[model samples]
Target: MSFNNANGGRQLTDLLIIGAGPYGISLAAHAKAHCLTYTLLGYPMHFWKHQMPQNMFIRTHPDSVYLSDPHESFTLLRFAAESGIDLPVPLPRPLFVDYATWFAARTGVRFTPEHVLQLSRTADGYEAVTEGGGVYTARHAVIATGLQHYSYIPDTYDGLPPGLVSHTFALTDFRPFAGKQVAVIGSGQSAWEAAALLHMAGSDAELIYRRDAANYREGQSGSELIQLGETFFDLPLEQKREKQVQPPGSAAAFLRPYVEGKIRETGNAVVQKAEAVDGGKLRLELSNGETRLFDHLVSASGYRIDIGRVPFLEQRLLELLEREDDGNGRYPKLDAHFMSSLPGLYIAGPLASYSHGPAFRFIAGVRKACRSIIPRIVRSMAHARSGSS
Candidate 1:
C-alpha cells in the first residue's frame, strides 16, 4: 500500500491497519465481511516475536482465545482437530502460534514483516515509514501493535549501561545471571517470568513490589473497580449516558499474585515488598527501611501511554493524544470505539486499553473491539467516499 501522490480529500484505502496481531486480524476479517477496502500490514502475531521459554503454558484457555475468525473456520479447536489435542481447552504456546500462522494463510491476510519507524498523517490519510526503505499510506489507520514494544524502564537504570540493567521484555533467559545477584521489579508476569528463568538458570534473585500483598488477587481487579465506580465515580447521569470508558484498573491480572508471585515462590527468589528502585539500587524506603544493590536490575513495570514516545504520531496529533488532566502521560482522549480525537484514526489493543475496558489486551476482547469500531468505519466510509482522493 504505497502513498497516493495526487491531491487528497478522501485518500486511498477505506482502512489500513498497523501491527497485525489478533486485534489487526479480527479487524481485517471484519472489514472483509463489510466489503470495505482495507489492508493489514505488519508481522502477524508479532507479539510472539520474543519466543516464550521452553516450558511455559498459555495463561488463557485455548478455546476462549481465538485469532482471526468470529467462529468455525479459524478456531483453535479446528487446529486441535488434527493434532488430537482437546478443543475448548488450553493448548501449548507453540501450537497456538502455529494456529495463528495457519489462520493467516487460510484467510489470505497479508502479513508484511516490517518494523514501522513512524506514523504521521498525510493529506490522503496516514503515512507509515519503515526502518527499511518502505513507505505506505492509508485513508484510515489503526494501531494494534500489542503491548510488548513500549516498556516502563525507569530512568534510574538508564545510566548504568548494558548488562547491568534491562527491561524484563528484552530478556529471554537468566542463565547469564547465574550466581549473580539480580533484582526483578514489578508484580506482573513479565517480572515473574524473568525471575523464574533466573532461578532455573541458577541466579540469586529478589522480586520487589510497590503494593501491599492484600491488593493481589486471582481474577482481575477490574470487577472490584467497576463495582466501586458504581458507588463513587460512576454517576447516574454518566451511566445514563454511558460514561464508563476505561481508565486503568487491573492489567496483567490473569498471571496471579501475578508473574511475580510464581517467581517469588521459587526457592532461589525472595519477596521484597513496599520498595522501589532509587537510583541504581533497590531502596526499601517504606514500612521497612532497607537498601540493597544487585549486579543487574530488570524492570517489569509495564507501560504507560506516552503519545510523545509514539513514532508515528505527529507533533500536532501528539497534543491531541494527551488526556485532559495535567499530563500524567496518558493517551489521546478516545471514544468507546477507540477512535482518537482526530477524525478517521482508530486504535486497537494496548494503546486503546484505557478507553476500551479491561479486556482490550486479550483475544477475548476481539468480538467487542471489532463491533465497536466497524459501524463507525462503515458510516464514515460513506462520507469519505463522497469527498475526494
Candidate 2:
C-alpha cells in the first residue's frame, strides 16, 4: 500500500510500528499478511549492528532466532540452508543480524530508516514526528524498541566519571583497553561475556558480582520455554515473578570454560563506594572489605524497563498511560491483547514482559506476541470502520 499521499502530504496508515527489531519486524510481517496498511520506522537491527561487540555470541539457541510471520516461511533454519551456513548452537551476533535482514527481505517488509522523535495523540489517532522531518499518522501504534535503550547502571557507580565508566551497551570495541586493567560488574551472561571478550582483546579484565557464586548452566535448546507459550501468561503474578528472576551471577555453561583461567572473578562483593583516583583511574571500595583500582569499569548490570526513558513518547501520552504498580513503575499494564490502557496503543518485546509474562523477554516470544497483537489490531480496526459507516 502507498504510505504517502499522492500530493506528497502527510502519510497515513492503519498501523505504525516504531521499531525494526525482532518484535517490530514480526508485527509488520503479520500485518502485511492480514492486508493491513502499515508503516514501520527505525533502522533494522540497529543495536545488534552498532552497539554489540563484534566478537560476542548470543546466549539463545539457533532454534530461537527466527522472526515470526503468519506462514512461518522465514526461519533461521531456512536461512542457514539457503545461505549455506552451518548454524551453531550458540549463534554468533553477526549471523543472527544477517538472518534478521534476510527475513525482512524475504517477507517483503520494508521500513523507513528514521527514528520517531516524538509520538503524540491526535483526534483521530496518533501522530509521529520522525528525526528526518517526516510526519506520519496511524490509527494504531505499537512500540517494539528493544533492550538497548534501557541499559541500567547501578547507583553505586554514580560518583565515577563517564569517561571511566560505561554500560556494556555503550562499549562496542575493547581494543582501546588492551593494556589497561578493567572491571566488569554483574554476574549475568552479559557481564561474564564482556569480561571474557575484554580479556581476549588483551585487557586485564575481572568479573565482580554480589552473589555467593556464579550460576553456570548447560546450553538451553529453548524448546521447553517456547512450548510454555500462552500458558505462562495464565499464571499468577507472583508466580510469574518467581520464574522471571534469573539466578544472580548466571552465565551459560560454555562461557565458564572460555573465561576460566583468563579472567579474575570475585563473588559476594559489591562496590560500596567509588572515586576517581589520580592518573585517570577509579578506586573502588568493596563490601568484602577490599579496595581496588582499575583503569575502567563496565557495568554489565543489564537493563531495567522504565517507559519514561522512551524519548519518543510525549509527556501527555506518558502520563495518560497506566503503569503496573510494580513498585518501580517499570512496565506498562497491558491487557490480554497486549494493548495498553490507552486505546489503540500497544507495547511488545521486553517492555511487555511484566504484564504478559517473562517469555516476552526473548526472541522466542515474538511469534506469541504477534499472534496476540495483530489479531487484536485487526479486530479493533474492523470495529472502528463499521461504527464510522
Candidate 3:
C-alpha cells in the first residue's frame, strides 16, 4: 500500500524505520531482500563517528560487529578480506565505522540523513515528521534509535557549573583536558577506557568508581553469548537478568595492562557533591570524606533506556504502548516477533533487550532481531494487501 503524501507528496512505503544504525540498516536490508517497501531515515552510524572517543577500542569482538543482510554476503570478514585489511581482536571504533559504511554500500542501503522530530499514529499506520519538514507514512514502524539518546548522568554532580562537568557521550576528544586534572566517574568499560584515553592525552586522569575493585573479564568473550542467538533469549528471566548486568568495572582483559599504570583507580568511592570553584575548577566531595579539586569531570556513567526519553515518540503513542519493568528499569514490552503492544509498531536494538534478551544491545544481535521481525512484517504487509484487494 503506497500513496503520495499531501505534504510535499513524499511516497509512503510499507515499513518506516526510524534509525540508521546497525539495527535500522540491517532491517532495511532484509526488507529490501524480501521485496518489501521500506523508508529508512537517519544519518548512518552517527553515534559511532561523532559520539565515541577517537582511538578507542570496543569490547565486542571483531567477528561479531557485522551489519546483517538476508544473504549474509557483507559480513565483516568479507569486508576485511575483500579490502585486504587484517581484523583486529578488540575492534577499533574507526575501523568498525568504516566496515559499516562499506556494508551499507555493498548492500545498497540508502537512508535519509534527517533527524526525525515527531512520530504519531496515523489513520492507516504511523507518520514520522523529519527536521526538514518531510513526512513519512508507513504501515509499520520500527524504532532502532540505539543508545544515542539515553546517556545517563548521576544527579549528584548537577550543581557543578556547565563546562566543568560533561558525560562521556558528549566527548570525542580528550586533548582539551591535556595537562589538566580530570576525574572520570563510573565503573564500566566506558569509564575505565575514557580515563585511559585522557591519561594518554596527557591529562592527570583518575578513575573513580563505587565498586570495591575494577572487575575485568579476563578470558570471557561476549561473542560466546552472542553466538547463542535465540538460545540465550529462551533462558529464564532470572538467568537473563544475571547476564544482562555485567559487573560494574568489567572491561576487556587486554585493557588492564595498557591502563594499569597510566591512570589512578579510586575504588569504593563516588562523588557525593560537587561545586564550581575559582579558576573554573571543580571541588568534589567524595563519599569517603576526601575532597579533591579537578579541572573537569567526565561522567562515563553509561546509559539508561527509557522510551519516555525518546523525543521523537509522541506522548499519545507512548501512552498507548505497554511497558515491561525489569527491576532495574522499564522498557517497551515486546512480543516474540519484537512487536510492541501497538499492533503495527515494533522496537529493536537495546530498547528491545528487556523483552528479547540482552543480546539486542550489541551489533551481533542485529541478525536475530531482523530475522524475527522481518518475516512478521512481510506477513503483515501481505495480509494488509489481501484485505485491501
Candidate 4:
C-alpha cells in the first residue's frame, strides 16, 4: 500500500517515535522500510537547528554513528569516503545533519518540526499535542530525543545577564570571540573541547571546574564491552542506592586519547579549579579568591531529568514510569526489550542503560538496543493483527 494511504487525513499510526535525532531517525527509517505502518514525528535534528560555528567536530568515533536500516547502503564511512573528507568517523555535527536530511529524503521519514507540547494515552492509542495545534495518535512510542530536550544551566546563574554567562549547550559560535578573553566552567569533554575550539579560533580561553583537576575519561583498551557498566551507563536505581555509587552522567564519560588531545598541553589555555563568583562585571572571582577578567563565558555545568522540561513527555504517565537512575533522578525503567514499565512504550539511548546496564550509551549499545526492540515491535504488530482478524 502507498504510505499516504496509511497516513491519509487521519493522524493515526502504528507507532510514534519522538525526537528525530540519529536514534529516532534510524528507528523511523527502519520501521517504514519494513512496511510496519509507523509514524515517526518530532523535529529532525532540532539540536542542529541553532547556529553553530563551522570549526567544531563530534566527540564520538565515525564508523559507529549510524541509522537502523538493514540495507547498509549509506554509512558515515561511505559519506566521508565520497566527500573525500577522510576525517575520523564520529562525524562533525554538520555532516551528521546532512546525513539525516539525505536519509529523510530517500526514505520518506516525516517530522512535524514543531515542539511536541503534550502526550497522553487513551483506551485505543496515544495522543501527541504539538505547538502547531495538531494532535496525532499512535499505539506505541519510542523516545529518542538524544539530549535535545535537556540543558545543564545552573540555578545561581539564572538571574545573571545572558551575555555575561551561558551554558555550553547554548553556545552557537566562537568566531566572534577571535582575540577575545573567555572563561569556560566545567571540566568535562564539553568544557575542554569548547576551550580548545575557542583557542584554535584565536580566543583566549580558561577552563574552570569545582574539582582540583580534570578527570579525563580513561580510554578503553578494548571494545566497550570490556568497560565498566557504570562507565558506559549508570547502574539501575535499586543497585545504585545499595552500593551508594555516584549517579551516571554525573561525571563525563571516561576520557579517551583522542578527547585528551583537545586539552591545552601548552600554556595557551588555563585550567583552574573553582566555583564561579557572582558579580555584575565580566571579571570572575576564582575559588582561590583571585580575580580574572573575561569577555565571555560558557558553563558546561550539568543536566537534570525534570519531566517538566521534556516537551513530549506525558505528565501523568511519567509519574507512573518509575525512576531508574538509582532513584537519584527520574529516568524510565525498561525491561530487556527496552520496553518501559509503562508497557507499549520503549526507550533508547543513554536513558536505557541506567536500567538495562551500560550498553545504552555506546554506539555498540545503540545497535544492540534496536536489535532487541525492533523484533518486539514487529511481534507487537503481528499480535495486534491476529487479534483484529
The candidate that achieves the highest lDDT relative to the unseen native structure: 2
Residue range 307-333, candidate 2, lDDT tens digits: 999999999999999998788887899
| Positional deviation of residue 70's Cα in model 4 after best superposition, in angstroms | 3.0
Q: Write one digit per residue (lDDT tens) for candidate 3, span 40-121.
A: 8888888888888758787876766678898888998998999999988778889988888888887777687788999999
- Better candidate number, 2 or 3, judged by lDDT: 2
The C-alpha stretches of model 4 lying farther than 4 A from their native spots are: 1-9, 49-54, 71-73, 81-90, 105-108, 155-158, 176-179, 200-202, 210-280, 358-364
Question: Model 2 segments beyond 4 Å from truth?
Answer: 1-8
**TM-score per model over all chains:** 0.75, 0.95, 0.93, 0.77
Best by TM-score: 2
Clashes of 3: 1
Pairs with backbone N, CA or C atoms under 3 Å apart (clashes), candidate 3: 187-249
Go through the candidates in order and give each one's C-alpha lDDT. 0.61, 0.85, 0.83, 0.62
Off by over 4 Å in 1: 1-11, 51-54, 68-73, 87-91, 155-158, 210-287, 291-293, 320-329, 383-389
RMSD of each: 6.3, 2.2, 3.0, 5.4
lDDT of 3: 0.83
Candidate 4: global Cα-lDDT? 0.62
The TM-score of predicted model 4 comes to: 0.77
Which of 1 and 3 is the better model by TM-score? 3
Looking at model 2, residue 205 earns an lDDT score of 92
